[model samples]
Target: MELLSFGDTGWGDELFKATFMTILVALVAFFFGFLISIFIVPLKLSNKKLLNYLGNTYTTIFRGVPELLVIYLLFFGGSSAVMFVAKIFGYKEFIEINAFLTGSISIGLISGAYTTEVLRGAIESINKGQFEGAKSLGLKKTTYYVFVIAPQVLRLSIPNLSNVWQLTLKDTALISVTGLVEIMRQSYIASGVTRNPLLFYSFAAFLYLILTTISLKYFNQLEKKYNHQP
Candidate 1:
């Protein structure tokens, strides 16, 4: 109890801040992954073999690799990659990629692969008659997608996206290896300092449980709302 106090006497403040960082990183990574999925989805759906092959390869590689390895590779190699580009442009200074960006990108790449699959499934589940109906109505391509296809895709995707959100949230714990002071990192620090590993780790787990529960409830509400729509 004293160990969880809010002042300098305890690690509560640090843990609270770490929890916030966890949420921030999860949100950013999820959205960034979704952005990546947007481009890849079309490629996977395309009739061209080359484009489909490229998209499938991207998803397969990221999904098959270990998440921690992805983080390690990106964190260690990102700066070198940037510096290589810089030298090509005649700016030869050393570049360093911060832990936050590295962690976010690594997690985002993984998330994107899963999201692409979820979205692809959602799109495929839509009845073919909807497309034919839209075309028969003489709707422009852009208008048809915007007003018809996108909403249903979103509605269909919400449940799976919720799963993605949970996965992304849990994945933030892995970013501790990059030295980001997320929940796991903070817990590790506090445990080492206090020699009370069980307490700190349990607290960290509690915080994560709270986050996941709240997010699950919110997604359920969203699912219900969408399901009720005409």
Candidate 2:
């Protein structure tokens, strides 16, 4: 309809941009979270009690907290922490955290918690004989992980990682509270301005459905590719 037209007469451009932003946020957050999980997974798998405890604590806290709460804490508390550190250096200016960073980091922390568990399961699923076999082959630690362990872990974990990606995509909606102009935020703004909440919100839902369906297809392809690997 006219309400969804491009340019000043409608919010088509805004919605389009917002959809892109949503994708960007989800991607950055998911990758960031995966990086975090890479570090935490070793901690959890370590034989040292302190290392294992620390990893468990990180995952438990992040997993137990609500995603919205995590965003609020990162958005508000991050600025305060930065300012505190700045003041300690005799600088008194107020600092505001970037919305994109806050959103990504918050979602990333949550995503990492879930990813850590998924990775742990995948790693544990690997047979003990593989480690012995790699050792007998005189492979270096790095080579063993890269060539042997990594591939199987990735293959086994792809299915669960797909779920994590979907959850991360949905979680991006919570970042709207940070005024990030993502899909939900743009829909809210357009709805408020046009007084057609149903139209814009429905459009937002459609956009999300498209994203999820495409992601599902991609993940399915990835799984098939990995399954075919010898």
TM-score of each: 0.97, 0.96
In the range 1-230, model 2's lDDT, one tens digit per residue, is 99889999989999999999999999999999999999999899999999999999999999998999999888889999999999999989878888999999999999999999999999999999988999899999879988999889989999999999999999999999999999999999999988999999999999999999999999999999888745
Segments of candidate 2 deviating more than 4 angstroms: none
C-alpha RMSD between model 2 and the true structure: 1.2
Q: 41-89 in candidate 1: lDDT tens per residue? A: 9999999999999999999999999999999999889999999999999
Please list the residue runs of candidate 1 whose C-alpha ends up more than 4 Å from where it truly belongs after superposition. none
Clashes of 1: 0
Clashing pairs in 2: none
lDDT of 1: 0.94
Candidate 1: worst 10 consecutive residues by lDDT?
Answer: 221-230
- Please provide the root mean square deviation of candidate 1 (C-alpha atoms, Å): 1.1
Give lDDT per model, in order.
0.94, 0.94
